[model samples]
Target: MPALPDPLPDPVAPVVPLGQDPGRAAADRLLGQELRRCREARGLTLRQVAPVIRGSVSKISRLERGESPPRPRDVRALAAFYEVDAQQMRVIERLLEHAQDAEWYEQFSDVTPGFLKRLIQLEGDAEEICVYENLVVPGILQTRAYARHMVRAVMPSAEPEEVDRVVELRAERQLRLMDGPLPRVVALLEESILHRRCGDAQVMHEQLKHLLHAGDTDKVSIRILKMSREWGVTPPYPITHLKFSNGEQSELAYVEHINGANYVTKPRALDDYRNALSNLRNAAASKDESIDLILKAQHRFGDRTAS
Candidate 1:
């Protein structure tokens, strides 16, 4: 079996769930996986295919692992090496081109492989982000220290270098909202998110201060769904929505537990999460009150709240 990625690490920063339509990415993933299978079926290993492609075993390994794109030359070489027909190679090459043009995220192949990088690009390019958090702050609101702690928590086995890379990637992801015409951001969080301290008190304080600023921004909103409210119906799950400038929208969600993570992207699967966020808006504290809640959380850090 492919090695399982490290368990759900605490996010260094909050990432609004980006529901990427994985049609092409899925197809590309299948292409790469299929290519690997074809080569294996031919009783050839990377060592065997290396000379034909004028590459090393590691390059072949990367292609098979879906850690990198299969170059056209590499694809043609491998296809010829595997005796695959021209028609199949054409399709694979097209997918490979799309993969190379990835626009969203690039640093998380360890956590997300192959076409997933492309999906992240589409999500990052979204015009609006609607997120519902069951626990903790969103990535955009997390301070660097808190974000690093979160990534490290679930990746205890990751090499120090890998952990730092993930932390750096998380920080980069958080920079999206600051650029371009700022996207609309609507975030709903369970009250407990305010209490969880993934980092030192100072880190939490900085995070809270950032959240307070976000709440005041016209482009951003952070709302709290406190436990004290008498919510008539419990939300079935967490959900996130990404809307494009053209009005295209997609919802993505996932749940994490002791077993691992179960991602949800289907429309029917995502409805409850969206609804839950909607319900929290009416049930939780007001937007203004939520801002105050975040202020209180940040104030817990020290005498100087914002600096």
Candidate 2:
């Protein structure tokens, strides 16, 4: 991976409460939404704004869709072009500032992929996170040993230092989410995850125990999806749906694949993931039942370790 530019220092601003930095990605999306609204309200199109910003139509579109970070000059130009009021410009400026601020995950850019970095930024800004996993426990719910083992298994070629950095990144992300009051997390795990051993029996036992403890929290919900013919097909890849504090932008659905991930924002696509999550929830065990299942799995692993 090429070297990434160092993130800008955090600007001195009012301290935001935990789990609420409006995150770089979320801020970009919010700014893009505002810019798009301004254009539409003025009966303008991307073509008209492209020239004003000295960019292409696609560039304007990317800005409007929050695909790229907004440049201050371009934002100012567009604000002037749209003749937005002082208050609106202030809001735009604030969003721009937030968007430019470095994300927490930037420190791990060497180990983190671009798509995963975006997900981490969104996670920080989300008010609620819904996760569905079939392969293994979600990163936020994984114990350190489990995380280390999983990382090594997945990235067989990674150096020891790189592996440690990746595991450290996961630990930091887990800490930020679990140590906060905001960003409620609901995770759905396929029962196979419990049976699929990532490491030694001891590691699996410890991981299951950690899941039980996480599920006991007020802000976290963990449910086990059982393997039954009645439930039909399950999503092949992992799905993460993030609902942000800003109500203006729509919810985002993330699908992770081997190479990269897709961010779903279109209503129809998002609805499909939402429906899948809802159906899985209905088919899965309740919280209490899930706890029982996890306990059983933990004991199974514990017995193996004891032997």
Number of the top TM-score candidate: 2
True lDDT of residue 170, candidate 1: 65
* Pairs with backbone N, CA or C atoms under 3 Å apart (clashes), candidate 1: 9-154, 10-150, 12-147, 13-139, 14-138, 14-139, 15-139, 104-121
For model 2, residues 189-238, the per-residue Cα lDDT tens digits are 99999989989989999899889889999999999998753746777778
Cα misplacement distance, residue 76 of candidate 2 (Å): 33
Estimate TM-scores for all models: 0.59, 0.67
lDDT of each: 0.65, 0.81
**By summed lDDT, which 10 consecutive residues of candidate 1 come out lowest?**
1-10
lDDT per residue, candidate 1, 153-173, as tens digits? 878788888877777766766
lDDT of 2: 0.81
